[model samples]
Target: MTERIAREPGRSTFIQRTRRAQLIACAIDVLAEDGYVQASLSRIAKRAGVSRGVILYHFSGRDDLLDAVVSEVYRIATEELRPTIETQSTALRAVRTFIVGSAEFYRAYPAHMAALREIVAHSRSADGTIRHSEHSRANERELSALGVLFERGKEAGEFRAFSTPIMARTIRSTLDGLLGQMRVDPGYDPVPEAHEVADIFERAMMRQSE
Candidate 1:
């Protein structure tokens, strides 16, 4: 029965992991629909078809559950954004592609956006480790992609020499503002606006032809 005892723990661990995933998914749905303040463990458990005690067994409290949901949202967002960031034909194109792709991703996944907004709104008083981690990862990827484009343009003498970090931050901030406007105004179409932003960015950075 040593083998049986070992198997039992392995099976228990698998079951626990599956249950936790289910609870996290339910939490995402609840938070997406109701926001953080209204997301309760009881509601999550009910949505997950599990008992409230089961949720408590996996997560210490509602805050812990919310944290896990935020992490998952970031994970999914990164996945959605990574492909466009990695595959641009030029740095300028990459930046524009990233901006437009991100807007499209949010439009397709409004629930994820809602969940993200709730996390930001509610996490003001909590430790910011997870949010900071997510932001850092996104910034690193975006900056790296922009750096590739900046170096390419500089080598071609088609763009002005400047700090990639600063430029990346400026572009990112612009995209963030555009996204905020799109989110606030349902009638705003980000595609045309994204192209305009890209044109302005390219013109600002590129050297004038003699």
Candidate 2:
């Protein structure tokens, strides 16, 4: 399949796309098993059981492939969680649903989360600085969306007095931390942790007695 991607332009576009997708899936596995820097094109190709030329044909370089990896992971995660978020009737429920959904998403797609974490931890620029700012904002966008939901909750008297920025950051940080921990600790379970996190935010977001 890798050899197919390097075929002439006359090849069907669909075949090229399939080869790229296969390479990307292999890259993801390499990233999760090895750290970011170690997930070189050769390593990814080997994982895909294809020649090195196959990966180079599809991706420009390490950075480009990492970008593709991050893009795919974010796409899959968002698609998985959005429907769960939409199922809730109110902002509070949305918040809980998002958290619980995230936990379930991680459990179901551990490799996706693992690959994403590796990319963030090791993605760098030619100047030796982190190049993850681009995708980091995508993750932050989810928090911002939650912030907007919280603001709506406040307006509707569903939430208590609090700064949305801080609240959103705290919640995002907690969930992110949980994911990190789950990666390192095999014994950790996200289900109960999801409930605990939801309960914490639920209490913090509730209006106090008049």
Candidate 3:
């Protein structure tokens, strides 16, 4: 099985990278429209207008392709939010921007998020364990980032003393719940929901005046 060279030494050529990206996008489309079980290599290849062999040349198999899909989604989201969040004048502002930025990403890439949900919910490993378990590296990194923001705010006297882990988990859960709502009702508007959630967290975390 040839692993993608994007994450390894001697990185793949432009054409190789482009082909892998194409297959990953098609996999996301298939997972979003047809769910996890139906998103076979052949189905994804058909969506990409390529033969199954073309997909095989890029990814080892369905599992590898799904893993790439998940990683690609995270890469896209970080690209969308990191610069904006970094530009915030304060950690408190960064937190707010993170919430709003996430909403913007969800609105722009509903298919990617939906496909991620399907993969997280249904994808399994050789041992039949869930692929994207709760303690997955991606989830850990997200929580760590939020914890950093909260700690910065506290140090700056902008936030109250609180359990950073609990607060971080709550914020992440609330944001994920909005996407779940969107899945249930496609007409649901998450931007407004994000604003409300951000307001709630700001109030809960902010240190009130004497």
Candidate 4:
């Protein structure tokens, strides 16, 4: 297969796209089941029932393939959450929906959530720096968006005076922790935990009756 692809570099676009998607899916499965340290290109290729050359044909290298895995997972999550979050009547509803929707998304896509966490925890950049050290661009973007929601709630008098950045970070941290909990405890139910979190935040942020 690799030889064929190499010889006919101008393969049909549909075939190329399908192969890339298959490789990415295999990578995610391997990452979720085997952890980041063990999810080598060869492992992914074996899982995909293809040669390593097939992966190289589609992606530059392991990092490039992992990047695609992350991008694809996030793309799916965003599409899943957008409708629920966007249709809310108020900022508070949006915030709650975001929280619950995110948990539901994790539950629905456990493998994806696990693969993403593994990638974020282990993937490094040039110069041996952690890609998600302190806070990666992806984290910053999520925090910034959450901060906007908090600010909107405050401006509308649905929430109390508080630091939006701090609250955003707090929520993000809690959600990340929830993923960790689910990984370790088979009995753990994130939906209930998510509801608790949503309730806590709603109460904490609600405006005091004047």
Candidate 5:
């Protein structure tokens, strides 16, 4: 008796990358309209003008695609925020600038804010085993840039001496909270609120009370 073995599908690395990018772009569109839980591979493929099979070939499942979307969103956000952290002459200024810049980014890309809200809402219920190796590496680089800003603030005696990790998370949480509020309130204008919040945060955190 002869038995037939199934043939493995073949796709080039370049093709895989291209398809993944297409899927990520489609995910952003879907997420923008329907949020994360509603974004499906079928819908994404339809929006991208690709077949569902093509999406499945590139991503193992929804979670993988969502992770990729989130990673790309972070990359874009980091790029937008980089100038605030990199070009600032002082740490206090960096912190204030970062907060204001982040708010502007969220205002410009409301979809990113929506995606982030979905991630935070779902992360608790999702499986922890799914590996996000690439996402983690990207996050590390973004954090490192923020860390340099924090260290500079400490050197200038503008901020209290503290663990960079803790400070980074604190700053991130503050910005997230502000963005979340803005997302929910239709009347909220990010630019004015961002400047107000930045002013308050800077005064609260700066070593010199003025």
Candidate 6:
């Protein structure tokens, strides 16, 4: 298996990477349209206009392909949001931008977001354990980033003193909750809700006014 999966005898790394990216893109679409249970390797291959061997050549199996899908979605989202988040001078502003930025990201890459949610919800290993638990890294990073923002706000006297862990988790949960709601009710508009959530947090985090 390793030999079959190794770098093609003469294929440049760039070509290999491009092929893998294309396969992942196809996988994302299939998973989004069909859900994890229904997204067969052949289905993804048919969508990509490739043979099943092509997908197997790029990925070890379904697990590997799904993992790549989750990783790519996170990579894309971070690429979209990080620059804007860096622009905010105040920690509170960063939090607001983070939520609003996420809404923008969802709007821009609805397929990626939907595919990720589906894979996370249904992908399972042979042992029946959740297959793609690696997303915890992204979750942890968000919590830590939010923690940093809270600390900065505290230092600047912009935010009230509070348990940063709880506050960070609360904020993260609120944003994720909006997405979950949208999955159930398509009528949910996240951008406005993001703004409202940001307002609620800003007030909660801000120092009590004189």
lDDT (Cα, tens digit) per residue for candidate 4, span 1-210: 654453232564667777888888999999999999899999999999999987887776787788788877877888999888888989999999989999999999988988998988786766787754322655777788788889889888899999898899899999998999988985677988999999999998899897
Single out the weakest 10-residue window by summed lDDT for candidate 5: 1-10
**Which is the winner by lDDT between candidate 1 and candidate 2?**
2
Each prediction's TM-score against the native? Answer: 0.72, 0.87, 0.91, 0.87, 0.78, 0.88
User: 3 or 6, which is superior by TM-score?
Assistant: 3
**Which digits, one per residue and each the tens of the lDDT, describe model 5 over residues 127-185?**
67534455556556757777887788788788876788876767677777877787688
Model 2 lDDT tens row, 50-79: 898767777766777788788788788889
Residue 158 miss distance in model 4 (angstroms): 1.2
Using lDDT as the yardstick, the better of models 1 and 3 is 3
Q: How much lDDT does each candidate structure score?
A: 0.71, 0.82, 0.86, 0.84, 0.72, 0.83
Pick by lDDT: 3 or 4, better one: 3
lDDT digits (tens) for residues 97-132 of candidate 3: 999899889999999999998987775677898765
Q: Candidate 4's error at 33, in angstroms?
A: 1.1
Error of 6 at 44 (Å): 0.9
Clashes of each: 1, 0, 0, 0, 0, 0
- Candidate 3 ranges with C-alpha deviation above 4 Å: 1-10, 123-128, 133-135
Using lDDT as the measure, which candidate wins?
A: 3
RMSD of 1: 5.2
Query: Which residue runs does candidate 4 get wrong by more than 4 Å?
Result: 1-12, 124-128, 132-135
Ranking of models by lDDT: 3, 4, 6, 2, 5, 1
The candidate scoring highest on TM-score is 3
Model 6, range 21-48, lDDT digits (tens) per residue? 8889999999878888888899999998
